[model samples]
Target: MLQLEQFEVRERKLQFIKEYDVEKIHQAKLIVDTDISSSVSLIELAHMVGLNDFKLKKGFKEIYGTTVYNYLYELRMQEAKKRLLNSSQPYYLMI
Candidate 1:
C-alpha cells in the first residue's frame, strides 16, 4: 500500500523533470544535485516515468541517445572525476 503511493509521487516528479528538459549536458549538474529520492523511484526510472519498462527503455535510447541508467552512471563518474582531479593529494601520494 505504501509502495503504491510512493510510485504515484515518483511519477509526478519524473513528469515534471521530463517536461522541463533542456540541454542535459549543462543541466546534468542540476539533475545530479536535485533531491529526486523523495519523488522518483531510483530503483526503476521507467516506472516512475509512467511507461512500460521496455518502451521507456527504448524511447530514452532513441530520444536521449543513451539509457537512463547509463546517463546517471556517467553523471556520477563525472562528479567523481571532478573531485579527484581538482583535489590536492596527500604529500606521500603526490611524491
Candidate 2:
C-alpha cells in the first residue's frame, strides 16, 4: 500500500546503502593491503560516503544496528584477529 514516489525514494535509498556497503568493503581491503593506519576519521568517512556528519552517523546506525565508529572498530578488530591467527604475530598483540 505504498505510494509510487515513496517506493521510488526507498529504492533509491537502498541503492545508496548498497553502494555504501561496497565502498566500505573496498576501504577495508585497502586497510588490509596497505600500511595505512587503521584509524579512520569520522567526518572524513562520512564525507566519502556522501553524507553529512550527523546524518551519516545516525543513518548508518539505523541501517546497520550499530554506531559508525563501533562498526569500524569491530571491523578493524576482526582484521587484526585474522592477521594474528594467520601470521606469526605475538598473541599479546591480538589482545
C-alpha-based local distance difference test score of model 1: 0.52
Scored against the true structure, residue 45 in model 2 reaches a CA lDDT of: 66
lDDT of 2 by residue, 1-95 (tens): 45777667656665655566645544533443353344567677666556566766655654455666676677767887788889886888656
Instruction: Give the residue spans of candidate 2 off by over 4 A.
Output: 1-38, 92-95
Clash-forming residue pairs, model 1: 10-39
Per-residue accuracy of model 1 over 1-95 as CA lDDT, tens digit each: 99788767666545644543323322432443463233344334443444455655544554455765676677667866776787798545743
* Whole-model lDDT, model 2: 0.60
Compared with the true structure, model 2 gives a TM-score of: 0.53
